[model samples]
Target: MLADVQKALDAFGEREINRVFFVGCGGSSSIMYASKYVMDRESTSLASDLYSSNEFIHRNPRQLGPESLVILCSHYGKTPETVEAASFAREKGALTVSLTFDPDAPLAKASEYVIIYEDGKQGGTFANEAPAIMLELVLGLLSSKEGNTKLDELLPSLENLRGIIDGEKAKSLAAAKAFAEAYQDDKVIYTMGSGANYGIAYWFSICLLMEMQWIHSHALHAGEYFHGPFEILDEQVPVIQLVGLDETRPLEERSLEFTQRYGKRIIVIDAKEFDLEGVAPSLRGYLAPLVMQAVLRQYAEELATARNHPLTTRRYMWKVAY
Candidate 1:
Protein backbone atom coordinates (compact mmCIF):
# COMPACT_ATOMS: atom_id res chain seq x y z
CA MET A 1 0.00 0.00 0.00
CA LEU A 2 2.85 2.35 0.82
CA ALA A 3 4.50 1.60 -2.51
CA ASP A 4 1.23 2.30 -4.33
CA VAL A 5 0.81 5.57 -2.40
CA GLN A 6 4.39 6.49 -3.26
CA LYS A 7 3.68 5.93 -6.94
CA ALA A 8 0.58 8.10 -6.75
CA LEU A 9 2.57 10.86 -5.05
CA ASP A 10 5.29 10.51 -7.66
CA ALA A 11 2.74 11.03 -10.39
CA PHE A 12 2.01 14.49 -8.92
CA GLY A 13 5.70 15.48 -9.31
CA GLU A 14 5.75 18.59 -11.46
CA ARG A 15 2.52 20.06 -10.11
CA GLU A 16 2.57 22.91 -7.59
CA ILE A 17 0.58 21.47 -4.66
CA ASN A 18 0.66 24.40 -2.25
CA ARG A 19 -1.73 22.94 0.27
CA VAL A 20 -2.93 19.53 1.40
CA PHE A 21 -6.32 18.59 2.88
CA PHE A 22 -6.96 15.51 4.99
CA VAL A 23 -10.73 15.04 4.89
CA GLY A 24 -12.81 12.32 6.54
CA CYS A 25 -15.40 11.56 9.24
CA GLY A 26 -15.22 10.29 12.86
CA GLY A 27 -12.24 7.97 13.36
CA SER A 28 -11.13 8.73 9.84
CA SER A 29 -11.14 12.45 10.64
CA SER A 30 -9.05 11.80 13.72
CA ILE A 31 -6.55 10.00 11.51
CA MET A 32 -6.40 13.18 9.48
CA TYR A 33 -5.59 15.11 12.66
CA ALA A 34 -2.62 12.83 13.23
CA SER A 35 -1.41 13.41 9.68
CA LYS A 36 -1.94 17.15 9.99
CA TYR A 37 0.01 17.15 13.26
CA VAL A 38 2.93 15.44 11.51
CA MET A 39 2.77 17.75 8.55
CA ASP A 40 2.83 20.83 10.79
CA ARG A 41 5.90 19.55 12.63
CA GLU A 42 7.83 18.27 9.60
CA SER A 43 6.92 20.17 6.45
CA THR A 44 8.40 23.61 5.96
CA SER A 45 6.47 24.78 2.90
CA LEU A 46 3.26 22.82 2.47
CA ALA A 47 0.21 23.76 4.50
CA SER A 48 -2.10 21.00 5.74
CA ASP A 49 -5.76 21.27 6.66
CA LEU A 50 -8.06 18.75 8.39
CA TYR A 51 -11.78 18.89 7.72
CA SER A 52 -14.66 16.61 8.53
CA SER A 53 -16.37 15.24 5.40
CA ASN A 54 -19.59 17.22 5.82
CA GLU A 55 -17.71 20.36 6.76
CA PHE A 56 -15.49 20.07 3.71
CA ILE A 57 -18.49 19.69 1.48
CA HIS A 58 -20.37 22.59 3.09
CA ARG A 59 -17.67 25.16 3.77
CA ASN A 60 -15.24 24.30 0.96
CA PRO A 61 -12.12 26.13 2.08
CA ARG A 62 -10.76 28.74 -0.32
CA GLN A 63 -7.28 27.21 -0.06
CA LEU A 64 -8.53 24.04 -1.76
CA GLY A 65 -7.78 24.58 -5.41
CA PRO A 66 -6.23 23.07 -8.53
CA GLU A 67 -2.79 23.04 -6.90
CA SER A 68 -4.01 21.25 -3.77
CA LEU A 69 -3.71 17.62 -2.74
CA VAL A 70 -6.79 16.32 -0.92
CA ILE A 71 -6.63 12.99 0.87
CA LEU A 72 -9.80 11.37 2.21
CA CYS A 73 -10.28 8.28 4.34
CA SER A 74 -13.31 6.02 4.99
CA HIS A 75 -13.11 2.62 6.63
CA TYR A 76 -15.77 0.93 4.45
CA GLY A 77 -15.10 3.42 1.65
CA LYS A 78 -18.81 4.22 1.43
CA THR A 79 -19.21 7.27 3.74
CA PRO A 80 -21.61 9.45 1.81
CA GLU A 81 -20.26 12.83 2.88
CA THR A 82 -16.67 11.79 2.27
CA VAL A 83 -17.49 10.43 -1.18
CA GLU A 84 -19.25 13.68 -2.00
CA ALA A 85 -16.24 15.66 -0.75
CA ALA A 86 -13.96 13.58 -2.99
CA SER A 87 -16.15 14.27 -5.98
CA PHE A 88 -16.34 17.95 -5.10
CA ALA A 89 -12.57 18.23 -4.80
CA ARG A 90 -12.02 16.43 -8.09
CA GLU A 91 -14.58 18.64 -9.79
CA LYS A 92 -12.62 21.65 -8.55
CA GLY A 93 -9.50 20.18 -10.25
CA ALA A 94 -7.69 19.22 -7.02
CA LEU A 95 -5.97 15.84 -6.92
CA THR A 96 -8.04 13.43 -4.83
CA VAL A 97 -6.66 10.39 -3.03
CA SER A 98 -8.56 7.97 -0.79
CA LEU A 99 -7.53 5.37 1.79
CA THR A 100 -10.15 2.74 2.53
CA PHE A 101 -10.68 -0.92 3.20
CA ASP A 102 -12.76 -1.38 0.04
CA PRO A 103 -11.28 -0.42 -3.30
CA ASP A 104 -14.56 -0.68 -5.19
CA ALA A 105 -16.56 1.50 -2.78
CA PRO A 106 -17.84 4.99 -3.60
CA LEU A 107 -14.95 6.88 -1.95
CA ALA A 108 -12.32 4.88 -3.84
CA LYS A 109 -14.19 5.23 -7.13
CA ALA A 110 -14.53 8.99 -6.59
CA SER A 111 -10.81 9.40 -5.95
CA GLU A 112 -8.14 9.63 -8.60
CA TYR A 113 -5.86 7.39 -6.49
CA VAL A 114 -6.77 4.82 -3.83
CA ILE A 115 -4.89 2.82 -1.19
CA ILE A 116 -6.90 -0.17 -0.06
CA TYR A 117 -6.23 -2.33 2.98
CA GLU A 118 -8.01 -5.48 4.08
CA ASP A 119 -10.02 -4.61 7.19
CA GLY A 120 -9.70 -7.02 10.14
CA LYS A 121 -6.69 -8.75 8.48
CA GLN A 122 -4.37 -6.88 10.86
CA GLY A 123 -6.58 -6.85 13.94
CA GLY A 124 -9.44 -4.72 12.58
CA THR A 125 -7.99 -1.27 13.17
CA PHE A 126 -7.43 1.40 10.51
CA ALA A 127 -5.23 3.21 13.06
CA ASN A 128 -2.15 1.33 11.92
CA GLU A 129 -2.76 1.49 8.19
CA ALA A 130 -4.22 4.97 7.58
CA PRO A 131 -1.75 6.99 9.63
CA ALA A 132 1.33 5.15 8.39
CA ILE A 133 0.35 5.39 4.73
CA MET A 134 -0.66 9.06 4.92
CA LEU A 135 2.44 10.01 6.88
CA GLU A 136 4.69 8.21 4.41
CA LEU A 137 3.03 9.85 1.44
CA VAL A 138 3.10 13.30 3.04
CA LEU A 139 6.67 13.00 4.24
CA GLY A 140 7.78 11.37 1.00
CA LEU A 141 6.28 14.23 -0.94
CA LEU A 142 7.83 16.83 1.37
CA SER A 143 11.23 15.14 1.34
CA SER A 144 11.51 15.79 -2.37
CA LYS A 145 11.22 19.51 -1.76
CA GLU A 146 12.54 19.98 1.80
CA GLY A 147 15.34 17.37 1.65
CA ASN A 148 14.60 16.23 5.22
CA THR A 149 16.73 13.21 6.11
CA LYS A 150 14.31 12.26 8.89
CA LEU A 151 11.76 11.21 6.30
CA ASP A 152 14.17 8.72 4.78
CA GLU A 153 15.04 7.29 8.19
CA LEU A 154 11.47 7.29 9.42
CA LEU A 155 9.99 5.56 6.39
CA PRO A 156 11.82 2.33 7.16
CA SER A 157 10.39 2.08 10.68
CA LEU A 158 6.90 1.58 9.24
CA GLU A 159 8.03 -1.81 7.92
CA ASN A 160 8.21 -3.26 11.46
CA LEU A 161 5.15 -1.56 12.98
CA ARG A 162 2.79 -4.51 12.45
CA GLY A 163 5.07 -6.88 14.31
CA ILE A 164 5.52 -4.49 17.20
CA ILE A 165 1.79 -3.83 17.49
CA ASP A 166 0.99 -7.53 17.32
CA GLY A 167 3.50 -8.26 20.06
CA GLU A 168 1.83 -5.75 22.40
CA LYS A 169 -1.64 -7.30 22.16
CA ALA A 170 -1.23 -9.35 25.33
CA LYS A 171 -0.20 -6.34 27.36
CA SER A 172 -2.86 -4.14 25.81
CA LEU A 173 -5.60 -6.66 26.46
CA ALA A 174 -4.51 -7.02 30.08
CA ALA A 175 -4.60 -3.28 30.52
CA ALA A 176 -7.97 -3.19 28.83
CA LYS A 177 -9.43 -5.70 31.27
CA ALA A 178 -8.38 -3.57 34.19
CA PHE A 179 -9.67 -0.38 32.55
CA ALA A 180 -13.02 -1.90 31.65
CA GLU A 181 -13.56 -3.28 35.13
CA ALA A 182 -12.75 0.09 36.67
CA TYR A 183 -15.17 2.11 34.53
CA GLN A 184 -17.92 -0.36 33.72
CA ASP A 185 -20.43 1.32 36.02
CA ASP A 186 -19.59 4.86 35.16
CA LYS A 187 -22.11 6.87 33.15
CA VAL A 188 -19.63 9.46 31.94
CA ILE A 189 -15.89 9.76 31.52
CA TYR A 190 -13.34 12.38 30.58
CA THR A 191 -10.19 11.80 28.52
CA MET A 192 -7.08 13.90 28.05
CA GLY A 193 -3.97 13.85 25.87
CA SER A 194 -1.60 16.29 24.23
CA GLY A 195 -0.02 16.60 20.79
CA ALA A 196 -0.75 13.68 18.48
CA ASN A 197 -2.39 11.64 21.20
CA TYR A 198 -5.07 14.31 21.55
CA GLY A 199 -6.57 13.00 18.35
CA ILE A 200 -6.41 9.45 19.69
CA ALA A 201 -8.17 10.58 22.84
CA TYR A 202 -10.85 12.23 20.74
CA TRP A 203 -11.26 9.16 18.56
CA PHE A 204 -11.56 6.79 21.52
CA SER A 205 -13.98 9.03 23.37
CA ILE A 206 -16.33 9.74 20.50
CA CYS A 207 -16.08 6.64 18.34
CA LEU A 208 -15.72 3.93 21.00
CA LEU A 209 -17.01 5.16 24.33
CA MET A 210 -19.77 7.42 23.12
CA GLU A 211 -20.91 5.96 19.84
CA MET A 212 -20.31 2.29 20.55
CA GLN A 213 -20.95 2.00 24.28
CA TRP A 214 -23.54 4.80 24.52
CA ILE A 215 -21.60 6.55 27.26
CA HIS A 216 -21.07 10.28 27.58
CA SER A 217 -17.42 11.26 27.22
CA HIS A 218 -15.41 14.40 26.61
CA ALA A 219 -11.90 14.57 25.19
CA LEU A 220 -9.80 17.52 26.31
CA HIS A 221 -6.30 18.59 25.34
CA ALA A 222 -4.03 18.45 28.38
CA GLY A 223 -2.84 21.98 27.80
CA GLU A 224 -6.39 23.22 28.05
CA TYR A 225 -7.33 21.17 31.12
CA PHE A 226 -6.67 23.80 33.74
CA HIS A 227 -8.54 26.55 31.96
CA GLY A 228 -12.06 25.21 32.62
CA PRO A 229 -12.15 21.42 32.42
CA PHE A 230 -10.31 20.96 35.69
CA GLU A 231 -13.29 22.35 37.56
CA ILE A 232 -15.28 19.28 36.55
CA LEU A 233 -12.67 16.89 37.92
CA ASP A 234 -13.81 15.34 41.19
CA GLU A 235 -13.41 12.17 43.20
CA GLN A 236 -16.25 10.43 41.38
CA VAL A 237 -15.49 11.47 37.83
CA PRO A 238 -13.43 9.01 35.85
CA VAL A 239 -10.54 10.51 33.91
CA ILE A 240 -8.44 8.63 31.35
CA GLN A 241 -5.13 10.13 30.37
CA LEU A 242 -3.31 9.01 27.25
CA VAL A 243 0.34 9.92 27.62
CA GLY A 244 2.56 9.82 24.57
CA LEU A 245 6.38 10.02 24.12
CA ASP A 246 6.33 13.31 22.30
CA GLU A 247 7.32 16.86 23.27
CA THR A 248 3.82 17.29 24.70
CA ARG A 249 4.38 14.50 27.25
CA PRO A 250 5.07 17.07 29.92
CA LEU A 251 1.68 18.66 29.28
CA GLU A 252 -0.03 15.31 29.75
CA GLU A 253 2.07 14.72 32.85
CA ARG A 254 0.78 17.94 34.35
CA SER A 255 -2.80 16.89 33.66
CA LEU A 256 -2.14 13.43 35.08
CA GLU A 257 -0.74 14.85 38.29
CA PHE A 258 -3.76 17.09 38.75
CA THR A 259 -6.17 14.32 37.91
CA GLN A 260 -4.48 12.07 40.43
CA ARG A 261 -4.83 14.74 43.08
CA TYR A 262 -8.48 15.52 42.43
CA GLY A 263 -9.97 12.49 40.73
CA LYS A 264 -10.15 9.15 42.49
CA ARG A 265 -10.56 7.10 39.29
CA ILE A 266 -7.67 8.00 37.01
CA ILE A 267 -6.55 5.67 34.29
CA VAL A 268 -3.29 6.42 32.55
CA ILE A 269 -2.39 4.64 29.30
CA ASP A 270 1.13 5.74 28.61
CA ALA A 271 2.67 4.81 25.26
CA LYS A 272 6.10 5.02 26.84
CA GLU A 273 5.49 1.60 28.39
CA PHE A 274 5.24 -0.05 24.97
CA ASP A 275 8.57 -1.11 23.48
CA LEU A 276 8.20 -0.38 19.81
CA GLU A 277 10.77 -2.93 18.77
CA GLY A 278 12.55 -2.22 15.44
CA VAL A 279 10.99 1.25 15.22
CA ALA A 280 13.47 4.13 15.08
CA PRO A 281 13.78 6.01 18.41
CA SER A 282 13.57 9.37 16.65
CA LEU A 283 10.32 8.44 14.95
CA ARG A 284 8.63 6.83 17.95
CA GLY A 285 7.30 10.15 19.16
CA TYR A 286 5.52 10.73 15.87
CA LEU A 287 4.20 7.17 15.80
CA ALA A 288 3.03 7.08 19.41
CA PRO A 289 -0.61 7.88 18.60
CA LEU A 290 -0.85 4.98 16.16
CA VAL A 291 0.64 2.68 18.80
CA MET A 292 -1.82 3.95 21.40
CA GLN A 293 -4.69 3.45 18.98
CA ALA A 294 -3.73 -0.19 18.54
CA VAL A 295 -3.54 -0.61 22.31
CA LEU A 296 -6.88 1.13 22.92
CA ARG A 297 -8.66 -1.13 20.48
CA GLN A 298 -8.16 -3.82 23.10
CA TYR A 299 -9.56 -1.48 25.72
CA ALA A 300 -12.63 -0.77 23.61
CA GLU A 301 -13.29 -4.46 23.12
CA GLU A 302 -12.90 -5.25 26.82
CA LEU A 303 -15.10 -2.36 27.81
CA ALA A 304 -17.85 -3.53 25.51
CA THR A 305 -17.58 -7.08 26.82
CA ALA A 306 -17.56 -6.05 30.46
CA ARG A 307 -20.59 -3.84 29.98
CA ASN A 308 -22.35 -6.62 28.10
CA HIS A 309 -22.89 -4.22 25.27
CA PRO A 310 -21.75 -5.13 21.82
CA LEU A 311 -19.84 -2.34 20.09
CA THR A 312 -22.21 -2.62 17.13
CA THR A 313 -25.34 -2.08 19.26
CA ARG A 314 -26.09 1.42 18.08
CA ARG A 315 -29.39 3.06 18.88
CA TYR A 316 -29.54 5.47 15.97
CA MET A 317 -26.35 5.24 13.91
CA TRP A 318 -27.80 3.09 11.14
CA LYS A 319 -31.10 1.93 12.60
CA VAL A 320 -32.97 5.03 11.56
CA ALA A 321 -32.57 8.22 9.56
CA TYR A 322 -30.42 10.87 11.16
Candidate 2:
Protein backbone atom coordinates (compact mmCIF):
# COMPACT_ATOMS: atom_id res chain seq x y z
CA MET A 1 0.00 0.00 0.00
CA LEU A 2 2.88 2.36 0.82
CA ALA A 3 4.44 1.51 -2.54
CA ASP A 4 1.20 2.36 -4.31
CA VAL A 5 0.96 5.66 -2.39
CA GLN A 6 4.54 6.43 -3.41
CA LYS A 7 3.67 5.72 -7.03
CA ALA A 8 0.82 8.20 -6.81
CA LEU A 9 3.10 10.71 -5.14
CA ASP A 10 5.69 10.20 -7.87
CA ALA A 11 3.09 10.75 -10.57
CA PHE A 12 1.98 13.90 -8.79
CA GLY A 13 5.67 14.99 -8.91
CA GLU A 14 7.12 18.19 -7.44
CA ARG A 15 4.58 20.42 -9.18
CA GLU A 16 4.10 22.55 -6.07
CA ILE A 17 0.79 20.87 -5.30
CA ASN A 18 -1.42 23.37 -3.47
CA ARG A 19 -4.64 21.57 -2.68
CA VAL A 20 -6.20 18.16 -2.06
CA PHE A 21 -9.80 17.02 -2.42
CA PHE A 22 -11.24 13.86 -0.91
CA VAL A 23 -14.25 12.60 -2.83
CA GLY A 24 -16.56 9.69 -2.09
CA CYS A 25 -19.99 8.72 -0.77
CA GLY A 26 -21.41 7.20 2.42
CA GLY A 27 -18.91 5.20 4.47
CA SER A 28 -16.19 5.93 1.94
CA SER A 29 -16.75 9.64 2.46
CA SER A 30 -16.81 9.27 6.23
CA ILE A 31 -13.32 7.76 6.26
CA MET A 32 -11.86 10.78 4.48
CA TYR A 33 -12.79 13.18 7.30
CA ALA A 34 -9.88 12.07 9.46
CA SER A 35 -7.41 12.52 6.62
CA LYS A 36 -8.75 15.99 5.98
CA TYR A 37 -8.50 16.79 9.69
CA VAL A 38 -4.89 15.66 9.69
CA MET A 39 -4.07 17.82 6.70
CA ASP A 40 -5.83 20.84 8.14
CA ARG A 41 -3.89 20.64 11.38
CA GLU A 42 -0.48 19.72 9.98
CA SER A 43 -0.03 21.46 6.65
CA THR A 44 0.72 25.17 6.47
CA SER A 45 0.33 25.69 2.73
CA LEU A 46 -1.74 22.81 1.40
CA ALA A 47 -5.50 23.24 1.47
CA SER A 48 -7.78 20.20 1.91
CA ASP A 49 -11.48 19.67 1.36
CA LEU A 50 -14.02 16.85 1.46
CA TYR A 51 -16.93 16.44 -0.91
CA SER A 52 -19.58 13.94 -1.69
CA SER A 53 -18.90 12.51 -5.15
CA ASN A 54 -21.85 14.05 -7.00
CA GLU A 55 -21.14 17.38 -5.33
CA PHE A 56 -17.53 17.14 -6.47
CA ILE A 57 -18.83 16.86 -10.03
CA HIS A 58 -21.48 19.58 -9.86
CA ARG A 59 -19.51 22.07 -7.82
CA ASN A 60 -16.13 21.34 -9.42
CA PRO A 61 -13.66 23.58 -7.66
CA ARG A 62 -11.67 25.93 -9.89
CA GLN A 63 -8.50 25.09 -7.95
CA LEU A 64 -8.45 21.54 -9.31
CA GLY A 65 -5.80 21.37 -12.01
CA PRO A 66 -2.32 20.00 -12.69
CA GLU A 67 -1.21 21.31 -9.30
CA SER A 68 -3.94 19.47 -7.39
CA LEU A 69 -4.35 15.92 -6.14
CA VAL A 70 -7.73 14.25 -5.69
CA ILE A 71 -8.26 11.08 -3.72
CA LEU A 72 -11.41 9.04 -4.36
CA CYS A 73 -12.65 6.00 -2.49
CA SER A 74 -15.29 3.29 -2.85
CA HIS A 75 -15.24 0.00 -1.01
CA TYR A 76 -16.41 -2.27 -3.81
CA GLY A 77 -15.24 0.14 -6.55
CA LYS A 78 -18.73 0.30 -8.06
CA THR A 79 -20.18 3.55 -6.63
CA PRO A 80 -21.18 5.41 -9.78
CA GLU A 81 -20.68 8.93 -8.47
CA THR A 82 -17.22 8.22 -7.08
CA VAL A 83 -16.08 6.48 -10.28
CA GLU A 84 -17.34 9.44 -12.31
CA ALA A 85 -15.64 11.85 -9.93
CA ALA A 86 -12.31 10.06 -10.39
CA SER A 87 -12.57 10.32 -14.17
CA PHE A 88 -13.65 13.92 -13.85
CA ALA A 89 -10.60 14.73 -11.73
CA ARG A 90 -8.24 13.15 -14.23
CA GLU A 91 -9.91 14.99 -17.07
CA LYS A 92 -9.46 18.25 -15.19
CA GLY A 93 -5.67 17.53 -15.09
CA ALA A 94 -5.53 16.76 -11.37
CA LEU A 95 -3.58 13.70 -10.28
CA THR A 96 -6.07 11.03 -9.22
CA VAL A 97 -5.61 8.15 -6.81
CA SER A 98 -8.35 5.75 -5.71
CA LEU A 99 -8.65 3.25 -2.87
CA THR A 100 -10.80 0.14 -3.04
CA PHE A 101 -10.92 -3.43 -1.85
CA ASP A 102 -10.82 -4.65 -5.46
CA PRO A 103 -7.98 -3.81 -7.84
CA ASP A 104 -10.25 -4.55 -10.79
CA ALA A 105 -13.09 -2.45 -9.40
CA PRO A 106 -14.43 0.35 -11.60
CA LEU A 107 -13.05 3.01 -9.24
CA ALA A 108 -9.60 1.42 -9.50
CA LYS A 109 -9.76 1.24 -13.28
CA ALA A 110 -10.90 4.85 -13.56
CA SER A 111 -8.09 6.44 -11.52
CA GLU A 112 -4.41 6.96 -12.41
CA TYR A 113 -3.26 5.07 -9.30
CA VAL A 114 -4.97 2.50 -7.09
CA ILE A 115 -4.43 1.23 -3.56
CA ILE A 116 -6.16 -1.98 -2.53
CA TYR A 117 -7.30 -2.34 1.08
CA GLU A 118 -8.62 -5.07 3.38
CA ASP A 119 -11.92 -4.85 5.19
CA GLY A 120 -12.49 -6.35 8.63
CA LYS A 121 -13.38 -9.73 7.16
CA GLN A 122 -9.94 -10.06 5.55
CA GLY A 123 -8.44 -9.67 9.05
CA GLY A 124 -4.70 -9.75 8.42
CA THR A 125 -3.80 -6.22 9.62
CA PHE A 126 -5.47 -2.90 10.42
CA ALA A 127 -2.92 -1.08 8.24
CA ASN A 128 -4.68 -2.60 5.23
CA GLU A 129 -8.04 -1.06 6.19
CA ALA A 130 -9.32 2.00 4.39
CA PRO A 131 -8.81 4.51 7.24
CA ALA A 132 -5.22 3.44 7.92
CA ILE A 133 -4.34 3.45 4.24
CA MET A 134 -5.93 6.86 3.76
CA LEU A 135 -4.04 8.20 6.80
CA GLU A 136 -0.78 6.83 5.42
CA LEU A 137 -1.47 8.41 2.04
CA VAL A 138 -2.13 11.80 3.60
CA LEU A 139 0.79 11.47 6.02
CA GLY A 140 3.00 10.48 3.10
CA LEU A 141 2.07 13.67 1.29
CA LEU A 142 2.70 15.79 4.40
CA SER A 143 6.03 14.08 5.10
CA SER A 144 7.38 14.46 1.58
CA LYS A 145 6.05 17.88 0.77
CA GLU A 146 5.72 19.71 4.08
CA GLY A 147 8.47 18.01 6.11
CA ASN A 148 5.90 16.78 8.63
CA THR A 149 7.35 14.23 11.05
CA LYS A 150 4.15 12.50 12.26
CA LEU A 151 4.70 9.32 10.27
CA ASP A 152 7.61 8.28 12.46
CA GLU A 153 5.20 7.72 15.33
CA LEU A 154 2.19 6.76 13.17
CA LEU A 155 3.77 3.87 11.27
CA PRO A 156 4.72 2.01 14.41
CA SER A 157 1.20 2.43 15.84
CA LEU A 158 -0.37 1.22 12.59
CA GLU A 159 1.83 -1.88 12.69
CA ASN A 160 0.41 -2.66 16.12
CA LEU A 161 -3.19 -1.60 15.31
CA ARG A 162 -4.58 -5.03 14.58
CA GLY A 163 -3.55 -6.31 18.00
CA ILE A 164 -4.87 -3.19 19.73
CA ILE A 165 -8.16 -3.44 17.87
CA ASP A 166 -8.57 -7.13 18.69
CA GLY A 167 -7.88 -6.49 22.35
CA GLU A 168 -10.38 -3.60 22.50
CA LYS A 169 -13.04 -5.69 20.80
CA ALA A 170 -12.59 -8.45 23.36
CA LYS A 171 -12.74 -6.08 26.31
CA SER A 172 -15.67 -4.08 24.96
CA LEU A 173 -17.91 -7.06 24.28
CA ALA A 174 -19.75 -7.09 27.61
CA ALA A 175 -20.46 -3.36 27.53
CA ALA A 176 -21.70 -3.63 23.95
CA LYS A 177 -24.01 -6.46 24.84
CA ALA A 178 -25.40 -4.53 27.76
CA PHE A 179 -25.98 -1.50 25.58
CA ALA A 180 -27.83 -3.59 23.04
CA GLU A 181 -30.12 -5.15 25.61
CA ALA A 182 -30.98 -1.79 27.14
CA TYR A 183 -31.39 0.21 23.96
CA GLN A 184 -32.76 -2.30 21.45
CA ASP A 185 -36.36 -1.12 21.83
CA ASP A 186 -35.64 2.57 21.28
CA LYS A 187 -37.09 4.09 18.12
CA VAL A 188 -34.27 6.56 17.62
CA ILE A 189 -30.58 6.72 18.55
CA TYR A 190 -27.88 9.38 18.17
CA THR A 191 -24.10 9.30 17.98
CA MET A 192 -21.74 12.13 18.92
CA GLY A 193 -18.00 12.70 18.75
CA SER A 194 -15.40 15.38 18.11
CA GLY A 195 -12.19 15.69 16.07
CA ALA A 196 -10.92 12.59 14.25
CA ASN A 197 -13.44 10.29 15.89
CA TYR A 198 -16.34 12.27 14.42
CA GLY A 199 -16.13 10.14 11.30
CA ILE A 200 -16.46 7.00 13.37
CA ALA A 201 -19.61 8.42 14.97
CA TYR A 202 -21.00 9.29 11.55
CA TRP A 203 -20.28 5.83 10.19
CA PHE A 204 -21.90 4.15 13.18
CA SER A 205 -25.02 6.28 12.97
CA ILE A 206 -25.51 6.05 9.23
CA CYS A 207 -24.15 2.64 8.27
CA LEU A 208 -24.54 0.53 11.37
CA LEU A 209 -27.47 1.71 13.50
CA MET A 210 -29.75 3.18 10.87
CA GLU A 211 -28.92 1.25 7.69
CA MET A 212 -28.32 -2.18 9.18
CA GLN A 213 -30.54 -2.27 12.26
CA TRP A 214 -33.40 -0.16 10.81
CA ILE A 215 -33.26 2.37 13.60
CA HIS A 216 -33.54 6.12 13.18
CA SER A 217 -30.14 7.66 13.85
CA HIS A 218 -28.16 10.85 13.45
CA ALA A 219 -24.52 11.78 13.98
CA LEU A 220 -23.77 14.87 16.05
CA HIS A 221 -20.58 16.82 16.57
CA ALA A 222 -19.79 17.25 20.24
CA GLY A 223 -18.66 20.82 19.72
CA GLU A 224 -21.98 21.71 18.13
CA TYR A 225 -24.14 20.03 20.73
CA PHE A 226 -24.92 22.98 22.99
CA HIS A 227 -25.67 25.25 20.07
CA GLY A 228 -28.81 23.31 19.12
CA PRO A 229 -28.61 19.51 19.19
CA PHE A 230 -28.68 19.40 22.97
CA GLU A 231 -32.32 20.50 22.86
CA ILE A 232 -33.22 17.15 21.36
CA LEU A 233 -31.61 15.35 24.25
CA ASP A 234 -33.88 13.54 26.66
CA GLU A 235 -34.43 10.22 28.37
CA GLN A 236 -35.88 8.60 25.27
CA VAL A 237 -33.17 9.31 22.70
CA PRO A 238 -30.12 7.17 23.32
CA VAL A 239 -26.94 8.98 22.40
CA ILE A 240 -23.89 6.82 21.82
CA GLN A 241 -21.15 9.29 22.72
CA LEU A 242 -17.74 8.38 21.30
CA VAL A 243 -14.82 9.84 23.26
CA GLY A 244 -11.41 9.99 21.60
CA LEU A 245 -8.05 10.47 23.30
CA ASP A 246 -7.22 13.33 20.96
CA GLU A 247 -6.67 17.03 21.61
CA THR A 248 -10.40 17.43 21.12
CA ARG A 249 -11.13 15.22 24.10
CA PRO A 250 -12.28 18.22 26.10
CA LEU A 251 -15.09 18.86 23.63
CA GLU A 252 -16.45 15.34 23.98
CA GLU A 253 -15.96 15.45 27.74
CA ARG A 254 -17.97 18.65 28.00
CA SER A 255 -20.80 17.21 25.93
CA LEU A 256 -20.75 13.98 27.94
CA GLU A 257 -21.19 15.91 31.15
CA PHE A 258 -24.24 17.72 29.79
CA THR A 259 -25.68 14.49 28.42
CA GLN A 260 -25.22 12.87 31.77
CA ARG A 261 -27.13 15.68 33.42
CA TYR A 262 -30.06 15.84 31.00
CA GLY A 263 -30.15 12.57 29.11
CA LYS A 264 -31.30 9.37 30.73
CA ARG A 265 -29.65 6.80 28.49
CA ILE A 266 -26.12 7.30 27.18
CA ILE A 267 -23.45 4.89 26.03
CA VAL A 268 -19.97 6.30 26.30
CA ILE A 269 -17.30 4.58 24.27
CA ASP A 270 -14.08 6.26 25.40
CA ALA A 271 -10.86 5.42 23.53
CA LYS A 272 -8.93 5.77 26.76
CA GLU A 273 -10.23 2.34 27.74
CA PHE A 274 -7.80 0.70 25.30
CA ASP A 275 -4.27 0.08 26.60
CA LEU A 276 -2.50 1.10 23.35
CA GLU A 277 0.76 -0.31 24.67
CA GLY A 278 2.90 0.07 21.55
CA VAL A 279 1.34 3.23 20.07
CA ALA A 280 3.21 6.45 20.78
CA PRO A 281 1.55 9.06 23.01
CA SER A 282 1.62 11.70 20.31
CA LEU A 283 -0.15 9.47 17.77
CA ARG A 284 -2.87 8.18 20.09
CA GLY A 285 -5.24 10.89 18.93
CA TYR A 286 -5.05 9.75 15.30
CA LEU A 287 -5.33 6.06 16.26
CA ALA A 288 -8.32 6.68 18.55
CA PRO A 289 -10.88 6.71 15.74
CA LEU A 290 -9.69 3.40 14.33
CA VAL A 291 -9.71 1.77 17.74
CA MET A 292 -13.14 3.17 18.58
CA GLN A 293 -14.55 2.00 15.26
CA ALA A 294 -13.35 -1.54 15.92
CA VAL A 295 -14.82 -1.51 19.41
CA LEU A 296 -18.12 -0.04 18.18
CA ARG A 297 -18.44 -2.74 15.54
CA GLN A 298 -18.96 -5.17 18.39
CA TYR A 299 -21.67 -2.90 19.79
CA ALA A 300 -23.32 -2.73 16.38
CA GLU A 301 -23.32 -6.52 16.13
CA GLU A 302 -24.80 -6.91 19.57
CA LEU A 303 -27.49 -4.35 18.79
CA ALA A 304 -28.39 -6.18 15.58
CA THR A 305 -28.71 -9.45 17.43
CA ALA A 306 -30.81 -7.95 20.19
CA ARG A 307 -33.15 -6.48 17.62
CA ASN A 308 -33.26 -9.80 15.75
CA HIS A 309 -31.96 -8.05 12.70
CA PRO A 310 -28.87 -9.13 10.83
CA LEU A 311 -26.34 -6.46 9.90
CA THR A 312 -26.56 -7.59 6.25
CA THR A 313 -30.26 -6.82 6.08
CA ARG A 314 -30.97 -3.75 3.98
CA ARG A 315 -34.15 -2.23 2.58
CA TYR A 316 -33.27 -0.13 -0.48
CA MET A 317 -29.50 0.22 -0.69
CA TRP A 318 -28.50 -2.13 -3.53
CA LYS A 319 -32.03 -3.33 -4.14
CA VAL A 320 -33.51 -0.10 -5.48
CA ALA A 321 -32.09 2.46 -7.86
CA TYR A 322 -32.65 6.10 -7.05
Q: What's every prediction's RMSD, in angstroms? A: 1.9, 1.2
Per-residue lDDT over 177-226 for candidate 2, one digit per residue giving the tens place of the 0 to 100 score: 99999988988999999999988999999999888988899999999999
Question: Which candidate leads the pack in lDDT?
Answer: 2
Candidate 2 stretches with Cα past 4 Å from truth are 12-14
Off by over 4 Å in 1: 120-128
Give the alpha carbon lDDT tens digit for every residue of 163-280 in model 1.
6787777767787899899889899988899887888999989999999998999998899998998999889999889999887899999999999988899988898888876778
- Span of 10 residues, lowest total lDDT, candidate 2: 8-17
Candidate 2, residue 216: lDDT? 91
Compared with the true structure, the alpha-carbon lDDT of candidate 2 equals 0.89
Residues forming the 10-long window of minimal summed lDDT in candidate 1: 119-128
